[model samples]
Target chain A: MAFSLLHGVHVPHRKNTRDMAAVRMDAPKTVVIPMSMHIGAPAKPVVKVGDTVKVGTLIAEAGGFVSAPIHASVSGKVTKITDYLLSNGTTVPAVVIESDGEMTPDETIAPPVVDSRDTLLEAIKRSGVVGLGGAGFPTHVKFSVDLGRIEYLVVNCAECEPYVTSDTRTMLDRVDDMKTALVAMKTHFGIRNIVVGIESNKKAAIKSMMGLMNEVVATGECTFTVKVLPSVYPQGGEKVLIYHTVGRVVPVGKLPIDVGCIAVNCTTLAAIGAYLKTGMPLVEKCVTVDGGCVKEPGNVIVPVGTAMSEVFEFCGGLTEAPDKVIYGGPMMGITVPDTSAPILKNTNAILALSKKETKLPKTTPCIRCGRCLNTCPFGLSPAAIARAYDKRDTVALDKLGVQACMECGCCSFVCPANRPLVQTNKLAKVLLKEEKAKEDAKA
Target chain B: MNTQLKLSVSPHIHSGRSTRRIMLDVLIALLPATAAGAVIFGLRSLLVVAVTVAACVGFEALFSLIAKKPIPVGDLSAAVTGLLLALNLPANIPLWQCVVGSLFAIVVVKGLFGGLGANPVNPAITARVFMLVAFATLTKAAFPTIVDTASSATPLAAEKATSLTDLLLGLHGGAIGETCAAALLLGGVYLLVRRVITWHVPVAFIGTVFLTSFIMEGMDATAALAAILSGGLLIGAIFMATDYVTSPATPWGKIIFGLGASLITFLIRYFGSYPEGVSFAILFMNILTPYISSWTRRRIFGMGGSKA
Candidate 1:
């Protein structure tokens, strides 16, 4: 029960499309792709309005050393270059294009000649493969680190978030691609231990991954194991997963690499394998569209810039008026103002929840039952942190380890008083950062 | 087309466990003790409990109206307070005294302090202390012996004379609810299973008392067992001392709170004039709860050997 100390609530696994194969959606009439999809600096657009571009064409180049390039998802003429609002309420510059009804591929869509490790890393960068687990971190940058120090390569198949089964679909349908990626990392990167951490609730996924690992092991390329974790919310979190699988602790403000582990999502690995085979950049995603308001719920493979409204329409539109359209799973998803937001590289699920699912409970005063403290995966006291944050007590917030909170919403979900513990933890982190910035400026 | 989509932070779902529901669970857990009290003390015990519950609810509602706050009597916290207060009172105590105790617990101790979760002390324990001080004779009055004889002494006062089985079965004289050891243990088990209360407080409190009593009685195990089975130790440990608002939340804090309570209780019972000391010990520890919580704050994960 070492992982038991990593406290989190058991969310309902509403994976309605777990057994359904993903159907490729027809290209929409228009697409609005945001320039800043990844975690680094926003990519700069190279094409202007009225420029004709084909699928896999580079529309936005990397803006910095850490940024990933963006490619066109459909053959189209650029209609407009404007600002678009994301589900998180932030505005980013976007390129809108009108499709010409032809699925034309770019001329640079040939498989790359990977002769060395550096070339493989370069190919990964050129493919614009970011972390498709919803973090959208540049994949090449993660692998660019010193490979000699890494001990384990962890494939995160723990699709622990509820109502999202896109990763599970990847494990079931794309096992060959997953195996190829894992074998490549082992043979090229010299990593010995390759572990695929999947929840036991996904028995099929565990079986598939285990079969792949056995086949790969028979070749004597590398040692592979499947670590079965008890299904819990946020089991896929980078730090939590590394801790559970490798028996390592990623310190605060540190990456998984610091703990001798490089963790990537299962879908990200499959996308990397596809890139290695075909050299096409990340331009489409498997989006799980299911909620109370959805008429026909299933997984749809849509282009990265497809509007949520178009996806919903393709799924037979709403059965009733929706009160919330979240861009991810219910536990950690951001609620969009409407259905017009375009899917990004990291958008895994678009849920149109009805009022029954999104209705907020009436909040009551804190009863000091310590349920939040018990449920926090990071072991931070959200109630105490919230109190310190409300009073603007930076010293107390720092002492209470407010910065350690992962914003997983476990505390808020378990709180009987409905105290908004996650929101307060987020704000408290922001406050701590501001205080640190102030101290740096003074110094 | 509907632009007015409801927006909030993450976690679009809740556990749906409301305060009212939790209070209801607690009331249900206390049923065994309530029934036992009624059977042992006769119908008069039920009247005391009913009157105290009504008075506590009424006072809370009246105070909210006067203070212009939203009435929170629906949460059933007032009912819990009333039941706890009635259980702490002597079976033969008058009903009007129960009303006064309910007023002190609800309006003065709980309502005036910003209501349910804001109170610094356990309302029932504080009110019981207030009543014991105000109506000393009534609180200390004789409990009708099981043999139909007039016995003015509680089992704790006649410690050596009372048999262990009589105390265990609650066949002797004491407060309305605290006398029924079997019923209290049953209720405690229910609360533990329901997870409404943790085991840290009750286990530490009773363990400390038993160990201290054993040492004080020259390592006499029977005397120690008799000491615990008699008096109000079970009721205070399971119900009153574990009150959510008044007790510490952290594991270490709860253990410290329980140890401090038992130490004070041992001193008062061994050296002081009172034969019973559970209520006063709990009240004293409640006053120090916040400090204990701050002192025993848990270490954040991955913060081992790091500077706070």
Candidate 2:
């Protein structure tokens, strides 16, 4: 009910790309499979050169507890296993497969013929499902909890960040898949309370899901609720959404799981639903490729690990070379080094921005207007901490709660004087954390 | 040929709002007051403002070039300084003195302090105070009333108090802008409507001046009114002293700022030697802005609210 201290920048939505057309699946000649797709250790290639592999077949198993398995999205001849550049500009081992036009999946773990609902845990683990939202944490790890505390299951349909409509389009086109996934989630977690929190900006998606949920509710298939959240940037953030929907705040440095709830992106759940019905693993993901620089900009269903070049090529090959290529939405996306880099499993959008869009002005000194403080959602002084870092004053930095900052770029967005507040705050947080660790060691 | 993409964080599309936009809006807001001055003072006021702006912009470019810093002439801070300097000056001041004031405002107060937003003090007020100390006679030059065409002094300069109407209409001669209370009020109102300034500073300033004078002078209505609407108070309290960078950030801080300026202005005009105290009051308050902001900062979120 209170005004959030931080007001995010109002950027152009660019959601018209999805409304203009349907999701077009890009059929590439050869899909480049990046071995390391999830957060932790890079995957080791399990197949060698000239090996024939089919869709849903695992090319590389999970390298560690934090890692997820890599699967082939298309039936193809394994051309070579070589070190290839990723979107982050780092080289990772990739499985290059030339599609044979058969589109045959090697083998699928058949849904429990008696009851697919019962195999939810094993299906999720074997499918190597990770959070498709952005963090890409292993989903199995979240459901593996026996603590019996998670009270609410929140489906994050709040693709509230501007220029991102992948989740919106997915929910629109795959409503059946969404409901099935929600039911599967409800069955697996053994929770009766379920809510889908979609931003109000997504009118069509809200309408579509609302109608479906209403029908299912009347039929007593399963209890489900669809709620429209106020359209605000970073409202999609797990903790912020938890507070807005459930009226609870996860403890500082903790997650939604700690607060008796779990929030999963709409795309992640839809993929789960498909995996349950058709018994397919997560091999390809829906990505929004729209910005000023691209000649044809729309959402395309892309195979995981497909070269970004092929994705651009399918969408009219870009009008001109982009000044910057980001892997997610404009607000929180990662800028990729080369188009040759493979799209990871968690990738949601590939924005190709022209030079005009990416041109940053030369930074001036901070005027101490306190706009940064007013807009920091975490309620820390970004400007003060940034100033302390600039002056190398660790004590000042520590006093201002510099370590609590999430580096959300909200401060930088609202600053009139354009001080590099976020960058400096990042340095301050790192230095102070290091200092605290040393003191702990000495004590 | 394989072209690699440069990877960076999100926010790929900028808002295109720049320092140039900020400085340009400030210049636009000062237009009404500048035009009013030109209309009241005739060609001389126009010449002073024009020459001051030209000199300030020229000096800024020249300084940046000599110092090998990137030229920020397009940012328009120099123009803002020049206009504020001209508004603070008397209409009869010579063109050479206008140039000197511009140099002091732009080169010394603004540029030497690291240019534009980095300047700790409001360059115009700092320059005006500096010039008043260096050239007292020229700073004190008075003009004839528009209606009577008779040589007159400001109500504040009177050994005996003048009428409230003369102070309000600014019929009595003073500085270029300080003579016209009506024009300054109109500009200040426009700025308020545009959200260029809040009502705290100007309202508190004028209110404290009137209230203090009433208390000290025992409800002598003419003296009380003159004390409120006198030299530089309207312009200084509204524009120069309320600058976002140099002023306090909180609402209460601005109130303190206005009250401080009013107290100082009254003490200097009635008790101290200076007939006008707007410049000194603003400068003094500007020095206290940081402390006032720190003291009056808002309680952060969740601090005053019920804990979860």
Indicate which candidate wins on lDDT: 1
Instruction: Report RMSD (Å) for each prediction in the order shown.
Output: 2.3, 3.8
TM-score of each: 0.95, 0.88
Query: lDDT of all the models against the reference?
Result: 0.86, 0.75
Least lDDT summed over 10 consecutive residues: which range in candidate 1 chain A? A1-10
Worst 10 residues of 2 chain A by lDDT: A109-118
Give the range where candidate 2 chain B is weakest over 10 consecutive residues by summed lDDT: B299-308
Kindly report which residue stretches of model 1 are placed more than 4 angstroms away from their true locations once superposed.
A1-4, A219-221, B1-3, B141-147, B151-153, B159-169, B215-223, B304-308
Over the stretch A188-296, how does candidate 2's per-residue lDDT look in tens digits?
Answer: 5666667788888888889998876775465453567787877766678776677777766666656677778888888888887888788778988888888777778
Query: B148 in model 1: Cα distance from truth in Å?
Result: 1.8
